[model samples]
Target: MAGTAPSPSGAAAAAESVSDLNYLLRPLHWTAVLRHPSGAGRSPLCFRLYTFAMASFTLSFFCSEVIVLYREGTADLDVFTLTLSVADTDIIWLFRMAHAIVCERAFHKLALQVGRDFAEFVTWDDIPVLRVQCRKVRRFTLTYISFGIGACSCYLVSPVSAEGLPFILALPFDATQPLGFGVTWVYCMITTLHVVVMTMILDSFNVSLIAQLRMQITLLSSKIVSLAKEVSERPENYSETYAQYELRYRLLKCIRHHQTIIKNADLLERSLGAMLLAQSLSIGASACFQMFQIATSENLALAAYDAVTSLQECPLSLKRSLLLLMHRAQRPLRVTAGGFFPLSRESFVSVVNVSYSFFAILRNFKNEEE
Candidate 1:
C-alpha cells in the first residue's frame, strides 16, 4: 500500500496494483482493525498468514545459525569464509526485526498520515514522478530477490566431498545422514525464500518513505513557483484588497503544506533512524568483506552481489529538493549512522573506498610477513 503510487489519471485503481504485494506494514493495518472495528473494513488475511510463516522460518533460521556457530569456530579459514557468505542474511534478519518493532510501535500513525495525504493532496501531475520512484523500488526489489535465489541455489547444489557432505550451512549434527540432510536442506531453502521476501518488502518500504517525502517537496516547490507567478501578475479587474486576501490565503495554504512535509519527515526519521544506523554499519562491513573476498577469491560473486544490492537511487527532482531542504534546515533531514555519517550513496561509495584501503593494508602486511 505504501509503495503504490497513483497513475497519470490519479485513479485509486493504481494503488490496487500493489495492494496484494503490500508485504511491509501489516501491523499498521491490523492494529487499526482492533482499535476501530466498525471502520476497519475487511483486512487482508494474507498479511497475517505471511507474517506468521515468516516468523516461524525466522526462528528456525536463527536456531540453525546458532548451532552452526557453536559447532564451527571462525578460527578456521574455511569457516570464516562460510560466515562471510551468509552475512547479508544475518543483516536482513536484523532489518526485519527492526521493521516489525517500528510497525508495532508508531509506524501505524505514519501509515495513516501517508494514506490521508495521498487522498487529499496528491494530483495526477504528481503521479508520474511517484510512479518513477515506485518503478525504481520494484527494480531494486527484483534484483535482491534474484541474487538471493542464485546464491542459495549455488550453495545447496555444490558437490559433496570425502571430508563430509557440504551443507547449505554448517550444522552441529551429522547432515550427511539422509534424514538430517533432507531436513537441513529444506529448512535452509525455506529460510532463504523468507529472507528474500523480507528484504524486498523492507527495502521497498524505505524507498517508499523517501519517495513520498520527495513528492511533498516537489508539490511544495510547484506551489511556491505558482504563488510567485500569481504575485507578479496584476489583473485589471481585481481590487487591491481582494488581491491581498487571495495572496494571504494562498500563502497560508502553502505554509500548511510545508509544515505537513516537515512533520512527515520527522515521523519518518523516528520510525527508521535506528534501523538506518544498523543498516549503515552492517552494509559497510559487508561491502568491505565482499570486496576483500572478491579480490582474493573467484567463488565470491555473491559477496559482490550483496555489496551492490542495498544501493537505492534518487530521482533528479527529488535530489534537487533534498539540497533545498538541507539548506533550509540548519540540522537537515539526514539519517545518520551513530551521528558519524549519513546513510546515502555517497557515503556507501566512501565505505567501499575505505574497505579497499583496508584490504590493501592487509595485503601489504601479509606480503611483508611472507
Candidate 2:
C-alpha cells in the first residue's frame, strides 16, 4: 500500500497519481536479509546515524510541501504535484539509508566474529595480535571519516542560498530557480572533504588488511616449522613420537586452515578494491562532466560531449570491477551501498571465507604432496 492515494478532488487526483508513480519507480529493494548470526544486536548501532538522517530527510519532505504551499497556493493539483516530487526524493534517500544500515550490520558482524575466533586461535605468543588490532583500528577510524564525507556528498547537497543551514534544503523552490555562486562554494568544500576522508579511510583499511593476513601467514608458517622439527627430532621413541605426530598433525591442519583464509582474503580485497574504484570513477566523472558544461566557449559543447562519453564508460569500469571480484568470491554482488563498505575489513572476510571454503574442498593439498 502507498502513503498517497487519489483524492476525490478532481484536480488533486492527478497529483496523487504522480506521487504513486514516483514511488513505483524506486521502491525499497533489499530482499537479502543480512546473513549475520548475531547481527540483530548491531542493527541498533547504526540506528542513531541513520535515524537522524531519515528524520532530516523526512523533515525536508515536509518542508518542501510547506514551501510549495507558501510560494504557490492550496490548489489541489499544484500541492499534489509538489507532494509527488518530495515523495520521490524521500524514497531515494530511504533506499540509500537501508543500504547503509545493511552494510553497517555486516561490518560489525565480521569484526566481532573475527575477534572472537582470533582469541580462540592457538598461535605462538610472539605473533603480533596487538599490532594487527592497531592496524584494524587505524583502518576503521580512517574509513569512518572517509565514508562520512563520501556519503554526504553522494547523498545530499545544501542550496547555495542556505549553505550554512542543514543539508535538508527546500526543493528547487520553483522550476526556474537559479543557483548563485554560493552553491558552487558549498559543493567545492563538500567535495574536498569527501576526497580527504575517502583517501584516508581506503589507505588505512588496505594496509591493515594486508598486514593482518601477512601476520596470520607468518604465525601459521612458524608453527608448522616448529612442529616439523619436533616430529623429525624424535622419530624413534614411541611415546615421544606419538606426541610429536599429534603436534605435527594439529599444526598441519592449522596451516591448511590459514592458507584457506589467506586465499579468501585476497579475493575479498579485490572485490572491495573494485567497489571503491567504481565509486571514485563515478564521482570523478560527475564532477568533470559538470565542469565541462559550465564553459561558454565555442568548444564548450564539444568538451561537454567528450566528458559525457568518457563518463558513460564509467559504468563499464564499475561492471568490470564487480565482475572480477564476484568471479573470485563466486557470489554475484551488486555495485551498491551494501556491496562496498568498511573498504577493507569486510572485504577481507568475504574473500577469506571463499579461501577457507576452497581449502576445505582441497582438505590436504600440502600433506598429499608430501
Candidate 3:
C-alpha cells in the first residue's frame, strides 16, 4: 500500500527525489569511476579503456616525477619543497584512483540499492524531507565543483605566466623547444585537470551517500513518532482487536524501514571503508564532515524510546516490538573505515592533533638545519 496508486503528480515527485542520488553520481559514471546505474553487466569496453588509460597516465606521471627528483636530489630547500608538494598531490591522486577501481563493484551495487530504497520509501508526505536534503546536496556539489575548478584553473594558469609546465617531469624530448613545450603543456593540462575533477567527484560521491543514510534515519524516526500519535488517537468505535492489529502492522513497517537503513549503511561502509580511512589520515576534516550522520543516527534511539513511552495503553506484544526497536536503535548506526575506526568527531580531533604534531616536528628539523 505504500507506493500503490500514487497520483501522477505524486509519482513524478517521487521520481525526482530518487533522481537526486543518481544526479550526484553522474560525474562518477562519466569518469568511469563507476558505471551508469541504468546499464547492466560490466562497464562498456570504452569505459574500461578510458579508465585504464587515465590510470596509466597518472601512474606514469607520478613515477616520472619521483625518478627526476631522485636523480637531481633535494638538497635545495625550494627543490625539496616543490618535490614534496608534487609527491603529495600525485600520491593522493593515485590512492583515490586505486580505491575507486577496487571498490567499483561495491559502489555500483550500493548505488542501485539506494536508488530502489528512494523509489520505494519516498512518499508524497516525504517529499519535504527529501527536498530539503536534496537542496543541501545540490548546493554542496556546486560549491565544491566550482571551487575545485577555480583552484585548478589558477594552478594551471600560474605555470603559463611563468613559461613553465604545470608539473615538473623528465620527458624524453627537450621540453623547452616550442613544439615539445606545446605538447608537454597540453599533456600536463589534461592530466592535472583529470586528477582534480576525479578527486572532487569521488569525494562528493561519498558525502552524498552519507547524506542519503542520514535522510533515511530521519525518515525512520519520523515514522516511529507518527506511529505513536496515530495509535493514541484511535477512534472510540474501533474494536480493541482491530486497533491492536493496525498498530502491529504499522510498527512492522517501521521495523522493516530500520532494517533497510542498516543494510544500506553496511553497504556504504564496505564500499568506502578503506578509502575513508585514507581520506581521514590525509585530510584532517574528513572525519569531522561525517559526524553529522553519526549524531543523527544516535538520536534515533531516544526518539524511539520517547515515542513508545508516550502511549498510555499498549498491548504487551506491541510493547515488545517497541522495545526491540529501541534496542536496535541504541546501537547507533556507524560507517567505519576498514572496520578500524568509526568516522566521528573524536577521530577528527585526533587526526588534526596528529597532523599538527608532524608539522611542528618538520618545522623544528628545518630550523635546525638552517
Clashing pairs in 1: none
Displacement of residue 363 (Cα, Å) in model 3 is: 39
Of candidates 3 and 2, the better by TM-score: 3
Best by TM-score: 3
**TM agreement with the true structure for every prediction:** 0.60, 0.39, 0.71
* Residue ranges of candidate 2 with Cα displaced over 4 Å: 1-39, 42-97, 103-105, 124-129, 132-214, 229-240, 259-281, 287-370
TM for candidate 3 is 0.71
On residues 51-144, what C-alpha lDDT tens digit does candidate 3 reach at each position?
7888777777788778768876756534544654566666777787778777776676666554465455556677667777868887898799
Per-residue CA lDDT of model 2 for 1-370, tens digit only, reads 1111233243233222221211111111111212233335455545355455444644455566556556655454433443444444344333433443445443333333234333334332433453455445555655576576666565445442334322323545332234634563454444334233433443343444455456556556666666667666754645866685677667666766585566647554543554455545544554343333322233444544555456555777765654454344433222233755433336657878999999976877766765
Worst lDDT run of 10 residues, candidate 1, spans 31-40
lDDT of each: 0.58, 0.45, 0.72
Ranking of all candidate structures by their TM-score, best first: 3, 1, 2
1 or 3, greater by lDDT: 3
Q: Which stretches in model 1 have alpha-carbon errors above 4 Å? A: 1-53, 84-88, 91-95, 124-173, 287-370
